[model samples]
Target: QGTLKYSFNAKDKSAEKTYQCEVDRPDPTDFSINCVGERTKLAIDIDRNLGKSKVYIDLNRFAGERFGFEAVRDPQTKQLD
Candidate 1:
């Protein structure tokens, strides 16, 4: 468990916030981490066996956009796509 700090600036305004984070490894090949704040949340997952990873973010009222990323590796070719 840990804490994450973030700062943002827009035009003439600036803000700072802190988030609490947790990490877990439920399986030998899998790992997960999550962080949450007053109005934001973030999550990440990784699977070593399958060579897959993902990330998710939500910035409730702080930003107008929410985004995520997903990636997979081709086992035979050893290439990520």
Candidate 2:
């Protein structure tokens, strides 16, 4: 138990996702931090949250440059293809 670290749980859900970290008998001097990251969500959220922060985007490049988009389904065929 000298240098053992563990993650207690994780969640993959429809609305949100989360994680947890746990350590056994942590030392008084030991400090820890946990962070959550996402790929597509981060890419999209960056532009959205930045906009809410009173930033300007007069260049009109946030659609593909900042927040990339994907096609979940084809409108014509209604399939993943």
TM-score per candidate, chains pooled:
0.69, 0.18
Write out the backbone clash pairs for model 1.
Answer: none
lDDT of 1 at 37: 90
In candidate 1 the C-alpha lDDT for residue 31 amounts to 91
Q: Between which residue pairs do clashes occur in model 2?
A: none
| Model 2 segments more than 4 A misplaced | 1-13, 19-26, 39-81
Model 2 worst lDDT window (10 residues)? 43-52
Residue 28 deviation, candidate 1, in Å?
A: 5.0
On a 0 to 100 scale, what is the lDDT of residue 81 in model 1? 91
**In lDDT terms, which candidate is top?**
1
